[model samples]
Target: MPPDLAIAHDFPLASCNTFGIDARARCYVRIASVAELAAALADPRLAGMPRLLLGGGSNIVLTGDFDGVVLHMAIMGREVLGEEGPDGKFTLVRAAAGENWHALVQWTLAQGLGGLENMSLIPGTVGAAPIQNIGAYGVELKDVLHSVTVYELATGRLRSMAASACRFGYRDSVFKHQDGKGLVIVDVTFALPTAWRANLGYAELAQAVAGAGLGAPGPADISEIVVAIRRRKLPDPALIGNAGSFFKNPVVSKTRCAELLAAFPALVHHAQRDGSEKLAAGWLIDQCGWKGRKLGAAGVYPKQALVLVNNGGATGAEVLALARAITDDVRQRYGVTLEPEPVFV
Candidate 1:
């Protein structure tokens, strides 16, 4: 594809991303290996432009046909980068950003590793995992992220940075910030725990997995539960185009949450670190009566209030406009801001 240029825009990304509805990349390539990807970046036509690093296409919104080249890091290789230790080798997993994330999780569980079981069934790449400090149930990628291999956009310099350099926080890291901006992630490493305790701390996950009777749940048990819950809840992108969880639940002081709760006794909320409370953005959108509401091509997901979907032929602009309306309405009613979870390009 593209004369040995790894694989070119010979394929369209309409179905590649979870947001099933979207424009195509002007020039696209699937670099089967990270070395080939590095070579592509060295090519003059592709050098020195504002580049976008994509993994599984689960967490992005393509507003329009891209003017720049899209580098699909399809490089696939998973290696134990180090020796196992007394507990379990402080195993190192070096994965190209393109590998299906859930598939990898299944692999790790099969091998008896434990750090990523809670993150099982998340719909993005290994590269983007550290970007959002991807979390589910009770575990976060930040808790296990060892390092990230990146290709800097402005200078094409490849560097491996540690977790501290990633500036991790609540659903955020340096890759999520503007400071470490313009870096294209190629590979990532995670230190999964051996003899790990399954994270049954999440209420729903606790009930379901514990009920699965998997005999004192391990990584495999938790993975099955996660996939089951996700399948039951999230609409497959293949069926309907959508980016999961359109907004982040705003973290506010408990005092503020009490004020809102006083206003609406049913205001759904969760406790967080210190005296903070995590308000559900979905609950807010649902409170505004946006659930399952239709507007031409775009509509709020019928099953999950957090997801915005493209009914059939919705353009990115229409989807974004709908999101803005929801945000404005929620803000107006609750006096709290709703932030988007997906990275926009």
Candidate 2:
């Protein structure tokens, strides 16, 4: 037999991420399929080690060597599941947990599917997308997610949950907290449309596309514009070691927003549906002069201060220290606590 299971013996995790930070998992397994995942989880060899589920490694800040088994989901598959709501021709596609999220977004747009064009260049995995309900350019994963199938770690049973059942909110979802605490996402289904109008209300996006000589654009056009804007602004994680965004935008009550706005007339905030307002964490960090500031390998990105970079070789602790300092500084200045977007394990 395969000695119960076959896995890489103590693999280095630094190269598996865009962050390029060095760390190691006591044990590591590359799950090529969900069947493989089941086998790995049941392997008696890894009984007591903590389990970690990782995808594209685009949004996490691995702060230390994991004293556990790490399962790298690489299962691959994609299919048009079906059509949906009022538009019989609109489609839904199922994506494997390992599928690159941004590539899938590009695929959908190329197929003339319109729901996810705004989220063009975001990096991560399809499975992880639903966890955070990934959003950009005014569109979020929850907006198009039809359902997600997960493998419960406790019982090894496959359970599928719908969007409403997923409890999706602004960058928050049930998969991220409850119901999915120990359940590992295996695949996700997205509801898409054959044709749709794009939301260009975001000033930067509007400016980018308008400047690109297209007032009203097609699905691909919008994707191109979004990518272009992102390219010009956000530093590529491949070149610079950093998770896409390091902090969650803080949502403050309208009264609090008013208070801050009065103090800083140019305060940037987006009004939420719940009467709260979401403040840009990047803007806040930039205002604090944290942008492009590094201390012994860890630093804030120059253009996108909300993103922290691992410049060459940052120990997990150093990056964490930088992040904690920024959070404290921002809190002391604005009286609003900032939360890190990455899950620290």
Candidate 3:
């Protein structure tokens, strides 16, 4: 380890993960600078051990204790990359990995940037955003993402990849693939258009904006509405230990969707641009009688069936069990597999 590196042994991680699972790392370190990250990557003590790169810990679940070195990213910085397009119509802004994702969105809105408003109130750090192709309402990170800077752990080299090279898909990207493994994202850059346009394609968001009497809402207006909607529909993780949206909406074939629609007239779904149907996982879980149900200290959020909450003193195993039970139930009933949104460790 570097002389200035801060490393902890057997660090407690009960408060790190949003799910509030009581897990411990055999070794843990906070990487606040690129030099520190490089040093950690080269540490012989940690070289052969399993490594977990943690950012905000909002989009992960610890099923058990981690018997490896946990690198908690804390690097911080942000700057305007420069202006481009006709009449300088586009501005590229970059944010460090440790910066709060929502705080970055708020900062962009404060600067009169509008592309990120629809994704307001989402959790996790900016570094993890593109890894999952994070999306909300009608916009995805890919829509505004310019590039990402990453430290290749295997080679101890820094590199950058443009948005197109990320190979973004629904809730996935190149960062999640084997070839992209051992890469630690340090920061993210977003290309925001100076010309603002409100994305009101999502029905609920459009309805909310309309009801607010804003025929044409600005970035701030849209952000406030999204925050309000999220506050009402999702439990605050600080108040209740839970990760938002425990499962991704399962995409199914159009024929399968139509068959299910005939059998269950009340099914809620969205037609994807590719002619497939995305079924609401929450609705499927709710139909299987999981809402507000409990197994040990883990339970489904009463307000949103999509969320799984830690109902006071929940263990990682308990949470995992509950998730597995719900997954099995949904699969058996609908013939659709439900994939977890969080990274399971």
Candidate topping lDDT: 3
Query: Please, what is the TM-score per model?
Result: 0.92, 0.95, 0.97
lDDT values, one for every candidate: 0.80, 0.84, 0.91
Tens digits of per-residue lDDT for model 1, 1-345: 424574355346677678875577656776776566766777776766545556788888877777677877676777767635685647777777777888888887777677888888888878778888888888888888888888786676789998899999887888767878777777888887655677777899988975776668767777878888888888887788887778998999999999999999998899986889999898899989999997779999988999898899887788888888998998899999999988777
lDDT of 3 by residue, 196-253 (tens): 8888999999999999999878999999999999999999988999989989999999
Deviation from native of the Cα of residue 291 in model 2, angstroms? 1.2
TM-score winner between candidates 2 and 3: 3
Give the Å error, residue 264, model 2: 1.7
Cα-based lDDT at residue 163, candidate 2: 88
Q: Pick by TM-score: which candidate is best?
A: 3
RMSD of each: 2.6, 1.7, 1.3
Candidate 2 wrongly placed segments (more than 4 Å): 1-4, 87-89
What ranges in model 3 sit over 4 Å off? 1-3
